[model samples]
Target: MNSATDVEIHAIKQVVATVEHAQRYELVEEFVSLFREDAIWTTAAGRLLIGRDAIAAFTWQVLPGAMKDLVPSYEVVHVLFIRPDVAAAKVRQRYFFPDGEPVTEEGGAPRCT
Candidate 1:
């Protein structure tokens, strides 16, 4: 693996920011738009979602009002460049109550990366 350029790092951060924004606002389309057509997404629940259509279906069913009393935060902790055009980003995800207390135990809520 090669070290990512500053520009690449910034782009990864922007993608994470977009995810945070989409989740915070429950914008399903915006969230799903981030995935490639062949992307595979594994949910926090350990469900394996294959392909963009599968992801969209699952997200559509769950994202609306999912954050009614909570806020989600996503931060890009690391990015590994596998090739010039491919990178894997590790994101830290946390959920908080409207009053800002971390949702420590909701649905087996452990800090996710």
Candidate 2:
């Protein structure tokens, strides 16, 4: 791989790592720190959150106790560079119990737009 590609991957991995860490520990502040001040996020259930404040509010409300027995894994399946600093990533994510049983059912996965 070229150095440019390697750099991009490394940068994106940092973002993913932060996300995973926040989710694993349910750290609302740390998770919210990853987003831009003007960023927008939509929940899997279709609620739209605009800006970091909105995202932080929502995250703090639900992250606690939401994954008491579930472990989530996120894989970056594809990454498309739109520009030198902008890219789109396709992620495959799923949840499983600590014992390794998959959580397969409706509402088990989140939809990202």
Candidate 3:
């Protein structure tokens, strides 16, 4: 991918930061607020959530106690500009222990992606 304009870069970064912060803190309402009313969200488990309302409903049900003792973080691996007004971002999400070690196989894998 070529260089993104400053505005585009800043906007994308803001979105990423917001999402990361929301997830790390289990801020379900804030996370849901990031999606558009007509947006579609697919769960890692293959559940399809259409519209912000459905997304919010699902999110609220599972966010709390989801992380428990672990912390979640996102790293933006790549960004592709699909259109002038639209972009697709690839992210690497990982869970870590409070001491900063990566959660391992004993943790039984990360859920609620």
Candidate 4:
């Protein structure tokens, strides 16, 4: 609602955009760069990855050809600021085929937090 919040939202949107770009192009390094050194990532298949190094390893193994037949998209639907410097974003993820057909279940409009 304030200028600071607006700026943060804009920055978050940019991060979401970058994520979409990286996934669309399967840029392993670019995708991994979004995580902090101590970040933890849980894959959709329930694989738990701890730390940037682990994340990088997993990404390198998967991201390169992950998008060969599909396009991944991320949209930030909500952003909850727990504090001045801490925020949690909710992102809606979808996949589409190269021909623009939805690859995942149909859902409502995409959003991110």
Measured against the true structure, the TM-scores of the candidates, in listed sequence, are 0.85, 0.88, 0.84, 0.89
Spell out the clash pairs found in candidate 2: none
Model 4: per-residue lDDT, tens digit, 27-90? 9899899999999999866789999999999989878877888788788989999999999999
State the local distance difference test value for candidate 2: 0.81
Query: Every model's Cα RMSD, please?
Result: 4.1, 3.5, 3.4, 4.7
Candidate that beats the other on lDDT, 3 or 4, i.e. the better one: 4
Candidate that beats the other on lDDT, 2 or 4, i.e. the better one: 4
Could you tally the backbone clashes for each prediction?
0, 0, 0, 11
Model 2 agreement with the true structure over 1-113: per-residue lDDT tens digits? 78998899878877887887788788889999999999999775778999999999999998998678878777677888889788998766677778988776432364333
Question: Candidate 4, after superposition: displacement of residue 39 in Å?
Answer: 1.0
Better of 1 and 2 by lDDT: 1
| Native-referenced Cα lDDT, model 1 | 0.85
**Local lDDT at 113 for model 1:** 52
**Which residue pairs show collisions in model 1?**
none
In candidate 2, how many Å is residue 113 off?
Answer: 23
Query: Model 1: per-residue lDDT, tens digit, 1-113?
Result: 33548888898899889988998999999999999999999987899999999999999998898889888888787888899898888887888889988887433334435
Instruction: Tell me the lDDT of candidate 4.
Output: 0.86
lDDT for 4 (candidate 3): 55
